[model samples]
Every structure is written in C-alpha cells, then in structure tokens.
Target: MIRNPSWVLRSYPSGMPTVGNWMLEDRPIPEATKGELLAKTLWLSVDPYMRGRISQAKNYATGFGVGDLMSGGGVGEVIKSESPDFKPGDIVVSDYFGWQPFTTIPASSAKLVAATDAPVEASLSFLGMPGLTAYFALLKTGDPKEGETVLISAASGGVGQIAGQIARIKGLDPVAVAGTDAKLEWCKQLGYRECVNHRTSADLVADVAAACPNGVDLFIDNTAGPIHDAAMLNLNTFGRVVVVGTVALADRFDQPDIGLRHLRKTLIARARIEGFLLDDHESEFETAKADLLSWFKQGLFETREDVIEGIEAVPYAFVRMMNGENFGKQLVKL
Candidate 1:
C-alpha cells in the first residue's frame, strides 16, 4: 500500500512564499495506463523560475492555482511502463512530475536519462536545464569572442557557474559577481578571471569596471537588480547582455519592477540585450546535452549540489534556495 504524498498550493504569496502557502496531502499511488509510465521520484529540483509558476500573474507557462499540485522537474526510476519505448527499472527525467514521491506520466512526456559517469542527479543540474540555459544563452545570445570579458551575476549559482566555465573554455575572460566571499572563492576555482562580492562591495559598478579593465563585453545576468545596473554601466561598445533569472526581484514580481533605467547606457554602448528561456531552444537540446556531457566527462566542468532528504523537506528546501542559503543547485532526495 504505497502512498503518493504531494505538496499542493494553498495560496499565492503576496511577497516571499512561506510553508503556509502549501499543504502536503497523502493520496493513493496512481497506476500506469496505456502509453504511460509510473515512476518513483529519486531527486527533485528547486529553482528560481518555480517562483513564477506559483504566482497569480500571467507567465509564459501556465500558473498553478490554489489546491493544484506544485509542479517541478524530477528524476525518477520507472516502476511500471505501459509504453513500448520504456521498461521497468529505467530512469527518466520529466518536468511534469509535481512535488510527489510517485507520478504516472505519459511516456512521451519523459526522456530517458543518458548514461553518465556523473551522478543521475546531475541530469537536473549542470547537465539539464541549468546547463542548457547557460549553453545556448551565452553562445547564442551573448556571442562571446576570444579575450572578451564576460561578467556573470550570480556566478556561483547553477546556471551562472556553468555559464562562467563555458566562457572560460571559449577563450573569454569570466568575471564573477556573487553575494558571498565564499561563493566568489568557489568561482575562482572554476576558472573565473576575476570575482566581485556584490553583497560587500561599496560601489559595485566601480568594482565591476575595475575587474573588467577593458569593459564588459558580455553580461550573463541571473540576479538582475543592482548587478544589472553595474554591468550596464561598464558595458563595452557592441557588448551583449543575456538576461536569465531575476531572483533579486522574486519578492517584487507582483509589484511593479521599479529600478534604475539603463536606456542611456544601452544607447551609449550600442549593447544588445535579450531575455532567455530554456524552453524556447528545444530544437538544440540534444546537441547542447552532448557537448555538456563531453565537457563534464573530460574534467572540464565542476558543479556543487546542496541536497536535503525526505519529501517533507521539499518546501523548506525551496525556501532556503530562494533566500540564497543553498550553495549551488538545490535538490530534495526522496
């Protein structure tokens, strides 16, 4: 008699979300039907983008309503399969799995986890959405060139860490801007040419400018707000800005995003700014995944995971990540 316990959205948050916004309920485990697979979740991912999903405001994807299951990405082992493409004991990853221990999803919606020397949990971090986001966003959007300075905000984060490493690999100089001294130290080990602790810096713009003596040619913005302002002020002529996450403004999503305008700097620097979403680059996923896997196996990449155990810890884990307490990719092992 297995039970499927899920975290359900109890209410939308007006500011930062609290555990009160969700309710965990126990239900019967669902059976796999035709063309579907029933899987037991092994690892669950908690990311900043999830903040948007729980919001009442409109997003590119559908938002969850009160009483709906809190959905996210998860890697699980197939316990039962009714589809010809999969069999029992196969491991798969899917975005359709909610905050639950077991899920029954259409086989077409999940992808088989490729064999890797790295832990299967890597499928959710550097080798999955975060890595893919960093890959296409930097290479395609930022368009890095040799010797150029690429400034990365949230440089120690899941996506930011990978982005900075990719920049270094491409012969570009990576300048890291993270919140803590410890995080900046980790970025240095990852090959970043320079590091700035935004939380302690008296003048971030000046610090960023000093780090990128030649001016920033590419800015991979993940935290936005002050980091965005700093990068814009130091952008080089013909530079590019790839907007990723806005974790700094997570609490203000429901309110107007009031901030310093960069229009003047944009015009003066002739810089190109573009927002990125991993979902938009589906056609290039396999190619990017192949490259990431190769780079990872060759010892060219490194990442950290802040993991917690049990289904009951999911909500608190997410809150910790949102508060910048998690060192790297935040995960829940069930």
Candidate 2:
C-alpha cells in the first residue's frame, strides 16, 4: 500500500534534461510471484548514462521507450517475499526497477545483503557497477604497476574516485583531475598522489607533465574534452589509456568532438586507448562486489551521494547530473 510517485520519460532530451521531459504517475504494486520479492526502494540512482536510455539511441543496452518507466539502479529493502533466496528485511540492488516506493524483483536480478552501519546505499554505488568499472579499467585494461604514473579525470565521480584509490593500492601514483575545489579535496582524501583542477588550468599537458614527472603510464578518462586532449600529449611510451566514460560526450549523446590528436600519440608512443562497459565484465562483478564489501567494512572506500528526495525529483536530478551540479553519484530516495 505504498503511495509514492513514479517518474516516466515523456520525451527524449537533447541537451539538458528537464522535469517536462519526465512524467509523474502513481501505480499500485502487485503481489510477489514465486522466486520474487517485493522490496521498498530506499534510494534510486540518477546517472548521465540514463539520459541515453530515454532516447532510442544505438546504445549498449536497449533504450527505454517513451512512456516506459524511467528506471535506474537502486538499493531497496525487501518487505515481502515468495522466494527461498530472499526473506523479509534483505537489502538488495536492482537495475530495472526504480523511481517508486515499491517494486517486484526476481531473485535472479536481486542479490540479498545483510545491512550494516556502512549503509546499504553503497551497494548501488562504490560496491556495485561503478566500482567494478574502476577496478577492471585500472587492473585489467590499464595494468598500472608500482612506480607507474596514472591520470584520471572526473576524479571525484563514482568511478574515478574508486579508480584512483585502487590505483594507489596497487602501488601506482594516481594524478587526479576534477572541476571544483571540494571535488579536488575529495580526490586528495581518496589517496590520489597528485590532484589538478581542470577548470582553472589551461595547460593540462604541462600540468600533467609536472604532476606526473615520469610521464603518465596509464590514463583513466571520464571527461574527453580539453583534459583528454592535454593528457594524451603526455603519455609515456607504450602507455595504456582506459576510456571508461565520457561525461562530456555522454551529455551530447556520445557524439564527442571529431578526431583526437592523441591518435598520433597512440601511434608514436605505441600507447593503447580502449573503452569498456561494466556489463562486459559480469563474470567479475560478483567477485568485485565481495571485495568492495570487505573494503567498505574496513572503511577503505567512501563516496558522496547527492540524493534528491522524492520520486518527483528524478527529472531534476537527471538534469543536474548532466549539468554537473551534483557531486559523486546522483540519486533519489523514494
């Protein structure tokens, strides 16, 4: 009997998203089926990648059609269950069901968690897709080693924050870049060896060269504008660049600016720049989830979530995320 609002996309957004772009509706939750659980959503995620979901873009995942419920990742507590796997009061994360107070989830799509003081909300952030994305990019693709220098943009965002911290744990010197003072401070707190402000600095190549005197051995990119252009010029020979995301490109529907001078660097330095999606690493997701849970228990990882309360706030949160107003991961509590 939860009476909460649900947000559904009314139309596709071109640049910045707006409330008009989303339609709010009310609906009743149905009974839980066999091998299913009815959970109350405590927190709902709002990410820039979601913008692509609203449009019928040729994306990695199927786009959410107009009039379909606009859902994202979420952390919820099961209140009713018909599955052997899940009982009452189990915290779980879901990808398809969101923007509401309650949803029915299949046991296969939901993983039960025993909640602790760390907040089950982290299961949707650092301990989930974003964290796994960072882990694989740094360790598997980038292959950063001790004494190596690494560069990361959007260092305060969910993926970049964990990527830099993981790089440090692996004995690499991580040079972090962010847009604001508060974010730079967070990057420092995350144990990044060096920090840079992309907004103030004009000479990113010089800044990256100064911060990473040995030349960047790997680049974990979240922004692909000026910062990427600058960092590519300073890559060490045979360096690796892991392109996990482009917040800037994502805003423009992944149509980033034409060409990269970095291509020359890739050819000359024999550096490899590759992109990846967390979905491609499902086999490793469970392993990463367990490892992240351990890290969270030990306080090895932490992130800021700009949570906008109420399901009606979903559209605004999406707008804010694309506008870069929210820090870390943007989400809504239903």
lDDT of each: 0.89, 0.79
Q: Write the per-residue lDDT of candidate 2 for residues 23-123, one digit (tens) a residue.
A: 88887775788888888888887765676677666877788778877677888889898988888988888786667788777778887655555677776
Candidate 1 residue spans exceeding 4 A from truth: none
- Runs of candidate 2 with Cα error greater than 4 angstroms are 31-35, 254-256, 259-261
lDDT of 1 at 281: 93
lDDT, candidate 2, equals 0.79
Lowest summed lDDT over 10 consecutive residues: which window, candidate 2? 250-259
Cα shift from native, residue 63, model 2 (Å): 0.7
Listed in order, each prediction's TM-score against the native is 0.97, 0.92
